[model samples]
Target: MSVLIETTAGNITLDLFVESQPLPCFNFLKLCKLNYYFFTPFHTIDKDFSVHCGNPNYPNPPNIISSSIIEDTQFQDQSLSPYLLAPKSTIKPTLGTFSFVKSIHENQQVFDSRFIITLSDSFDDSLENQVIPFGQIIEGFTVLETINNTPIESIELKRPLRDIRITYIHILHDPFPDPNNFHPYPLEPSEFQLSTMRFPELSKTTKDINSDNNNEYNALTLELVGDLPHYSIKPSPETLFVAKLNPITTSESLEIVFGRFGNVKNVNIILEPKTKKSLCYGFVEYNEQHEAESAYRKLSKGCVIDGRKLHIDFSQSVR
Candidate 1:
């Protein structure tokens, strides 16, 4: 069953499995119908294997769902036991997983919503039924990937972490977060945590980088790793990557309007981190080198944004 899970960035379509694990599936579906999963999160995220959501608390889980630290996937002579509430293994978690920690006694049964999803791909054996793949992501994986790449400094752990935030969720017949309000987080989490979309160029080496923005104009560069927001990996062009224009003229709008005239490959808006403002400029990446020149000659004049005539041109060299 595919259901629409809307996020602030966009809507992620999901395919729910009703048969694999009935209890968790029912719980998940119930939460969906009741909107109990609204404004929740899949906090434990792995870019390679999976992304996990489903903490009990609004922002955090009250207690880990699996109380008893039982065996997960390593038990020998194990028959495919079909019905259990929590996971009974120690294996590292994977994507699309909804495994609950289980107990050795089988009496200490507990289950909450702590779950994960697989962002890491290209592994055959890693995701071998270890995690219960209850539902699949449809639309918002890109946005979700962006979130997974966000770098967060763990003041507590004294390390960095992937920025995972859930702004809203609609679960059925489950307990809603707000007793007063009818719906969950209507605004998307990304709207609140904008910085998390792209991986920070400056990895969290020290606390001051996160605290102070105006440290120095260090060129932000990083090793390509973990949840990349989008496939933005082309080398910076020799020409500058901005198009000066008035406010209200968006990069997307320009791409749509001008790209039709010729073989324009792509459009990009360069944004300033602190200000969150586009630098009043854009990039028109054409499919062929010649197409860019021709389009620049033809369409660079009288571009209108917010009724303001704009100047379109090649940007500074990106090195």
Candidate 2:
């Protein structure tokens, strides 16, 4: 069985292990069918670990009458196999492995509404019995990367400052039939439950480029993605690739020059390692998209920095 989760960032498709792990897989699929995951925020995002989420709408499982639901006879007494709970010792989950958040309710193991997606290559040994692996993200990994790189409020909370929610869950294939009383929402929820719809941008009327807090947010995002310390392929709308810089031009000078357009997050001037001299081309990342667009338009028109007329374009590679 497979399901497509459409989120604010993008779409993600998961291929579930329905045959081996039917109960939890059935629970997840049933939730999707009933639109129970609608507008559920990705409440926790541990950059080096995983992103967690579930039905924030309810604290406990819904009070459904036993007679209203149908049960698969084969899976009624079937418990999750030992292998599902205990992953291979040598094999660590490497990005996009989906699992249930195991918890103890009334002294029994329960896989409730919550789930988590692996974000890194290394797995912590302590979480071996804490989560049950039942599926893997089969598509939209770029979307997963986008969610993984999202900046949180702080190291302690791990909640995204802005909401990254599941807008819709589109179930592609399911072998089990729905219960008789199962009735799902006909349309997507209209209520917007986010603190902020999006990060603040450089507005058209704002005279001060540094007035907003976009720079801080951008900095946090860059730090989470390892862009500040090391170079990573993060080709985005706000990044610009500049070429033909004067050998004398420094990253600091580039920042000062570009700070006129908007909030300059970072300026990376590529250099020869042996000599530590400028290669005469680098990248300048802005805090917002329009700022980059403005910079691209104004600077692309024969702008000079240090003695060279800089050639500017949107960066396609990592610094």
Candidate 3:
């Protein structure tokens, strides 16, 4: 099957093997459809190497599509004819990518949220038919390699240049490739380019004071406290911008506040059971983070929202 691997930089086509990794394929596909992949950057990219992504505590619950490991006629047929297959190495080099990661258990599969790409060009005979080869990147190897090689730290591995990120991810189709193995089209940009028309300008005095006051708009501290993995890019609608709100606020209030900042595509306010009150913290989705951050700030600090003073912050609102 075909899907797109999106990062903050750009998008690349990933030709996945639904026939082989049925569950992982489905999960990846579902996540893509939910536009979950568009903004999430592979926090750990090993240049011309492997690209690993998916951190559940991401913008959202992380649209992870899972299934039981079952073999059907589709995936049962396996052949080693494919030129690009995951090869085993003393250490799997970040090349000729695979949708997996180094986990705690030998056979444990917590990596359903994490996938890797290979960088090695030649496949060693030792790796022949040993590991599952799901797919290869159809395009943007340079961009992918750049991400892998970038100097950063991995939230999971806690290593630099390990955790790369994309605002979000999406999958598009070209319908011109072979059905058995399609080299899918690259997913298009979800971020909208605002047209610059005759923009409004004010006096320098006003501008300077407003700029200073804008900073005074009140800042919320998000020290990346949670153990949840951080993305190369923050969450947004088009990106991985997950909205957080207080318990007392209703969905309508969220939409009103967030929708006003930008075009809010979806807003979901999670609530606690039994009492059925707002969880005080839920996800708000915007087409971009600029909009989400704007909303978060506007609605924070007694902004006269929902007939009450709202306490908004990035640290999970952990009330």
Best by lDDT: 2
Tell me, by TM-score, which candidate is best: 2
Query: Which regions in candidate 1 have their CA more than 4 angstroms from the true location?
Result: 56-60, 63-110, 122-130, 154-164, 170-319
lDDT of 2 by residue, 1-319 (tens): 2766667665576888776776667777877877767767676788878888774442234323221111333234433343256333233456788887776655776666678889877778788778877788765677777788887778887867656667566565677666555677643333233212333332342334353754454444333333233223344788887766788888999898889999998888766545676655678999999999999998888788777787787764332
Error of 1 at 292 (Å): 46
Alpha-carbon deviation at 201 in model 3, angstroms: 28
Candidate 2 ranges with C-alpha deviation above 4 Å: 58-92, 186-319
Give a tens-digit lDDT track for model 3, residues 1-319.
Answer: 2644444444455666555454445545544544434324444444443545555333233322331111122332333234224233333333555655334334553334455566666445454334445567755565655665566544455334323344334343222212232232333222221111011222233345444453222111011212113312233323222222344677787677667778876666544334555533345667775876777766654455545444444322111
TM-score of 2: 0.52
Model 1 weakest 10-residue run by lDDT: 67-76
Cα-lDDT of candidate 2: 0.65
TM-scores of all models? 0.39, 0.52, 0.39
